[model samples]
Target: RKQLLAREMGLEPPATVELQESDKEIDPLQVSVLSVSSFIAQMRTVVGDGEATESARAQAARQLVRLAEAGVPGADPEQWWATQTVAEERPLNNKPRLSPSRIEALLKCPLNAMLKDTADNNSDKYHLVRGNLAHAYMEALGRGADEELARRETVEAFEKIQTSPTWKRAQERDEFEQLLVRTNQWIQETRGVLELVDVEVRVDVESEPGVRITGYMDRLERAVGEGGEEGGLRVIDLKTGSSKPSDEETSAHPQLMAYQLVLAHGELQQEGGLTKVVSSSQGEERDGATLVYPGTDTKKIGTADQARKGDEELAEFAALLPPLLDELAGPRVTARISPECDRCPLKPICPVQAEGKVTTDVNA
Candidate 1:
């Protein structure tokens, strides 16, 4: 800096003054001045090291205590939290109405499923906000609101929340416009088959005598096949996340199957389930479900995954839920470690994985 200043002033930099470039490698063993905190921390490390002698560790421990007694910055007793007795975790006793999403979570990890509502879910709220707002906007559009009206109405609703993470109203509004464009383009290019009828429709049905299933369907659409032949009602599930489910997963998606179960069994028979929602019902069964993905990629506005619906398949999937939920609701919930474990935020308090997974084990 001195040399640079001298050169800037047009005086030749002194030959004795030299500054090492920032890119130069630093010597690891080079001694440097230590702050009181750093020195105390080093002493602590020495005290804790297994290789350190008993006498040396004892001396270091004494020094730490002495520092704590003194008004030292590092060795404060108040820093250590008082440990409390942890409550014993038990499985849920009462049966929960298995929502489509909840079923999916339980299928992955019942422990996760059980704790999500209670735990401090550190999942990305930004994406969640965007997803919710997008849904509202899409719903508004589906219900015959114009583009601008939908965007405005969505923002007005979002702004009503008293507490939320910081994402500007203007930014959300702009993104709503982008979502509107992408979803429209996506519908034209990929999701042209199903026409949107209902948005955010709830399906609550006691499929079995004891067990119940429920979820909010993103949209209920009538499938328009070749020659404009109106097919059965198709469940339209919108996914606003960065990653969409694989083709295979989408085909056998439990959530869609669950929704279709309600559809197939005529649980949603009120208000003319098929005829009222769409004029041309033809009294046909649910054809299938479509999972729409509005891509982050602008050039490709549309991406989708389809799940075929059959009464037998839907029935079979529905049958599996009661036993699974019953097992999960009990004390013996199994933690099925899968790819999602890598992204799960509950690891620190997770009953199974709180002590950390084997870092070196290939199978783990």
Candidate 2:
């Protein structure tokens, strides 16, 4: 009908298209567009053929299985097989380090966490850039940078970052500047509570032998008691996003809990160079952990019981790591689809998503 209409409009009929034969040679890149299952099915034919040698057939079958298990789009089965084989044979003396954020990510979806480590999909979205700038400004303030210098440096740093290709398309430049101003104002307003401010301090605690939990504390403050004695340690995490603390989120807040555990174990003071300052103030206990959202009326403070619960949860998670690592090291790793799949970069090729098992609403 479209051809007839075109002819009536004084145009020649479109040329008839010829379909390529199914057995015709195809570009390797084009073959990458095939679904993992379809590709595996095709590979199976070669593996089952009597003409192929036993060793060659076995190798092809192994490659097919690896590709199916990877569940990532456009991943080269042969390359993945070779790389995984080499990695499997390597001596893994170095223990895997778990940060609070990484722990949270793993809990949401193990496959997502694994892909985050291996994928090169780093983002410089508005929120991420603003958060980073906020952190830098807070770090400078904590490190004793005069308010004026800190403000100037933060703006300069952000300006330099704006020139980079990573942030070339960053939106909301004015909003980011306002955020900096508000952050500086917050620093000034909270100076009384932030008597001893340590910024970007590295805290490492070995939950168990050969298993370590490591992270950087954005701000660690030494609070003063009513009687002028050392009150205790306060771990404050800055947030630039819209997420507020809820009973559910705070109850299992891995980051805050990790900070509490580190402080409870006295590792934050001992290993993080806080011993001198902390000891000088007579070695006070942990007061609590707070998530501070500057420029917003949102502050989530975890109770003492919540912090202790976090310690227990961390231990339990550590105990489960060996088995989880063993499973991931094997040829096949199961994907447990959840609401998190909506944001997962691998969802495009995820077998579970392909099968329509993923939920659409993250809140649901």
Candidate 3:
């Protein structure tokens, strides 16, 4: 009918088209599907075909060259090189120096970790500011500041921090005052046991030759034995947050585990020239790590067994670092949408969040 209409309109009739089903089963190998590179190659063939007009051929050639130079979308050259096989081992362009926070970030969401590092988002979040202030105050107090002096210094530090443009908001100022009061109370309660051997002590370990894991112990205390000799050590981390970490949380805590590993391997003593202290009792060892919530009467202490397990877990994570780093360095990474996304500053720009995978926690 279309051919007859075209003839009546003084135009050439359309060519007859026939539809046919193949006798042979469908073969994926025979299908015509082009990847970016394959499409470029096919275009190059078109460019070289002598039957095509010079202008058409030139256009095809130009497109092929432009695509080749641009390369594939979302393809990382470094990642490709890292994954390729080589005759001799070469040091990676990017070494995987890790910390507990980074490990946790990677576990929660690889995309989050990558974006957090690259994007300058949420640098001045209230939670971050609060946490930093608490850490600074604790560090100063642990360094042997007298009660009167520490309190004054903490206030001064808080004032100094508030001077920053990011923290100048009235609401932040109100929260800061409340946090300061809680911090001061915590200091008074823990003053009796605040004899810290080291404050903000750095622990650096080459878990594997090139895989370096490093973190800082918030406070370290020596346990004196019956003979008045130094016994085991207690690693303590101060928590300003309301939520008290559970026993399970403390047991699997990577930061505390990293500290434990440094102590277990005698690296802490070697690095600081500290004495190797053991428990005074017949069998019990006071050597362990704990998260102390100063304002509250809550403490999450890791058992000796849990400490050992933490060391093992950290070692396993360190061993897996090389490949994990490579994967994260790649352009493609997994973005998990969970309750955590609610607090993630990157949510606005996150593809997964845009897809409506994010949901608010009713309990929260």
Which regions of candidate 2 are displaced past 4 Å? 1-93, 117-129, 163-171, 268-284, 295-334, 355-364
Candidate 3 has what TM-score? 0.55
lDDT-better candidate, 1 vs 2: 1
Per-prediction TM-score, please? 0.62, 0.61, 0.55
State the C-alpha lDDT per candidate: 0.65, 0.59, 0.57
Top TM-score model: 1
Residues 1-364 of candidate 3 have per-residue lDDT tens digits of 4465345334456797774566346676544454765555455555667996676566665665565567744233232322344433443335556664566677677778777655554545545666777777777666656756665666556665554466466665655555555655654554444445777767666555555556666777665555667656667776666666677877777666655555654344434444332212132223667676544533432222234444456567456566556645554466787778877767765757753332312121
Candidate 3 deviant stretches above 4 angstroms: 1-93, 117-123, 160-195, 224-229, 269-286, 295-334, 348-364
lDDT of 2 at 61: 69
Sort the predicted structures by lDDT, highest score first. Answer: 1, 2, 3
Tens-place lDDT per residue, model 2, 1-364, is 3354335334456776665797466667435334665655445555667996676566666666666577645335444322333335543433456665566666666667776445434453534665787898878777777877777777766666564465543554555666666666665666665565577877666555554556788777777765667666878777776556786777667677766656755433454454322111122367667676554533432222234344456566456555545434544445677877776667755656743323322221
Question: 228 in model 3: Cα distance from truth in Å?
Answer: 6.2
| lDDT score for candidate 3 against the true structure | 0.57
Q: For model 2, what is the C-alpha lDDT against the true structure? A: 0.59
Ten-residue region with minimum lDDT total, candidate 3 = 276-285
Q: List the lowest-lDDT window of 10 residues for candidate 2.
A: 275-284
Total clashing pairs in model 2: 0
